[model samples]
Target: MAKLVQFDRLGGPEVLTLRDVEVRAPGAGEVRIRVDAIGLNRAEIMYREGSYFDRPVFPSMLGYEAAGVVEAVGEGVDGLAEGDPVAVVPAFLQSAYGTYGDHVVVPAAAVVPRPAGIGPVPAAAVWMAYITAYGPLVEAGQVRPGDHVLITAASSSVGLAAIQTARHIGAIPIATTRGAAKRQRLLDAGAAHVIVTDDEDLPARVKEITGGAGVRLAFDPVAGPGVEAIAQGIAPGGTLVVYGALDPRPTPLPNAHSYPALTSRTYTLFEITKDPERLRRAVAFVNAGLASGSFTPVVDRTFDLGDIVEAHRYMQAGDQVGKIVVTVTHDAASD
Candidate 1:
């Protein structure tokens, strides 16, 4: 039996509860991971609230990122063994294979050997944010050196990752936040310019920062009427990649009909994860960045696994500047 987080009916963080259940042995092409650290994402909150892409089944476990020791491997699994330290990539759907547990079994292909010297907490935080940023910025956008890139919601873990990823390619990252409180923190995280959306005119400031050329690429998670302002901030012929829908309002695409040759594409993290070749390239790029010290996950704070309710609540509060992590004590591993 293993301790896993489950929610019967969806509502809020209050719905999450820990329960002990029989953990099945690994099947073909699967591995059992004794998770030590779990990363918290706003998507988890959306899933809990029944607003995510996949509706949660009652008594559902929902998570997609973790790091831990490999406890066992199943038939046909290669290059992995018992006791190997590994990071769980967000390659699978949370509704299909949740990581929010002390002990969980997942597909072998979804596990990456954790880099040496990267502890569980940082490893747990790495894959989802970095890969999410990497797909749109590097692979799809094909951002070039010295190009200006706009990152909305600049204080998010994915936002910070986009900053570093842009810098990794010598591109200039212009980060945008709704308030001024996280400006310095975003700069510290490698954003070249930080914009306070509430206080400054977004397109005007972006134009001023880019010398009227405007940003060549924009990465945005919040898709709504606000996208019109973001669209106004992009250079002609530039690309806007929308990866999420934080705002429930209707998204207006000024660039599609009103602007000059501006391109807009809707993206999801699954674009890379679901493609074998893309996933391979992403893993290589991120692994190289990690090994060279160009990429490091910024963990804003941590909570005990038992305090997951607080973690979820904190995520909903949106006060954190980076990833919020959860550490498992494993006292219930024996359950």
Candidate 2:
């Protein structure tokens, strides 16, 4: 029997329960994995609160990304066999194959070979946050050399990835957070300039950093009233792409009269994964970045499989400095 985490009803962290179940063999084109490490994201929190755009059925298993060793391979699966170490991509699977379990079945396309010299915990934490930021900064925004970039929520894992990516593209990475505590950390994390919004006026600081030219692109995860403030900071023809709604309130539209040529749009993984070619391209780009160490996943806290309740509590506290992880097997060195 495989011990797995499951939720029967949508509510709080209390709704998540552990259970033992028969481990089924994989079918054609599928592979079963013995999970080593699991990546935790805010999306899982939204899933439990029943507020995520994607809703799971009752008794659903919850997890999106993991790194594990292949235990069994079904017919027609190629390039992988039992005992191969791999990392699952950000593709969502059915409840039957969720990554929260000791064992899971996933399609071959959903698994990627982990790059050399990266440990399982960090490899497990790589896919979701890195790819989410990669799609916007490189693919959508078309960030180029000498462009000025502004990234909000600059302390998150995705926010850190954007900083490195903008640096790679030769763009000046100017990041923002609400407090002074993370200013030095973000600057050391590759941000060319870090602004504490609560301490200084955001738009004015951005203008000063860019020499009154304004940023040409803004990547925002926090939306709502802040959207108007961010919109006003962009150059006359700049673009604002919002990926996550940390704030529940509706986003106020950019003032058309103030900057008639400014453009803004909301983005989600759904839109980026809509086409097979685009999804394949995104996966390849992230894999390449991992191979080159141009992108690295940061882990702030790790929970044992049995300690998910505590993990949820820590996540809700909102003090995390990087990606939170869960492991099926304990590692003393993780501390």
Candidate 3:
């Protein structure tokens, strides 16, 4: 039997419950992993709250990131063996294969070897955040050295990853947060500049920071009326990649009334992860960054598997500065 989290009704974090169930062995092209850590994401919360892009089925399991050791591999699986340390990427739909469990069977393509020295907790936090950021900044936006990039909601795991990723490429990352509490932390986390949205005007401040030139690239997850402000701060020919819907309201595009020629597009991490060539390039790039010490996963807090409810509450509070991870334990020990 394996322990996993599931919820029949949607509404809040309280809906999540831990239960024991039989975990079937991996089938063809599948890999079963003894999950040691699970990463928390906003998408999970949105899914639980009935606000996600995909509607949930009753008694649904929802998760996308985890790190563990491979326990078995099915037919056609190659390059992986029992006892190998691996991390699951957020390549598939959460409804299809959730990772919030002690053991899970996932498509082999979603599994990647965990880099040496990156333990389960950090490993669980890596792919989703970095890849989400990478899709917009490096792959699509083509951010380059010295390019000024604006990152909104800059304290979330993905936002912080954008900061690190921009720094790795020699780009200037200007981070934005809802309040002043996270300003220093965002700066400490490598943001070239921090903007506290509550006090300052986003468009005005960004324009001032860029000497009226505006940023070369703007990465935003929150869309709504606020997106127009972000669009106003982007340079002509610059790109604003919207990857999420933190703001539930309808997002407004740049109006024709004296607006700059800013290009805006909706992007999802799947755009890169779903394509074989793009996924290969993304994985190789991230691996190189990790090997060279240019990229590091930041963990805000960790909770034991039993404390998942409290962890979700904390995430909903929106005060976290980085990734929240849940650790799992087994009675038997292995080398």
Every candidate's lDDT: 0.91, 0.82, 0.91
lDDT of 1 at 150: 98
Each model's TM-score?
0.97, 0.93, 0.97
Worst 10 residues of 3 by lDDT: 326-335
Predicted candidate 2 versus true structure: per-residue lDDT over 14-79, tens digit per residue: 888878888889899888998889888888888878888878887788888889889899999989
Candidate 1 lDDT at 144 equals 96
* Runs with alpha carbons beyond 4 Å of true place in candidate 3: 333-335
Q: What C-alpha RMSD separates each model from the true structure?
A: 1.3, 3.1, 1.5
TM-score of 2: 0.93
Q: Candidate 2 — what's its lDDT? A: 0.82
How many residue pairs clash per model?
A: 0, 0, 0
Residue 46 accuracy (lDDT) in model 3: 95
Candidate 1 Cα deviation (angstroms), residue 258: 3.0
Q: 1-335, model 1: which lDDT tens digit per residue? A: 78899999989899999998899899999999999999988889999998898888778998989999999999999999999999988878777789999899998988989988999999999999999999988988899999999999989999999999999999999999989989999988898899999999999999999999989999999999998888888999999899999999988876456555788889888888878788889989998898899999999999998898999999999999999999999765373
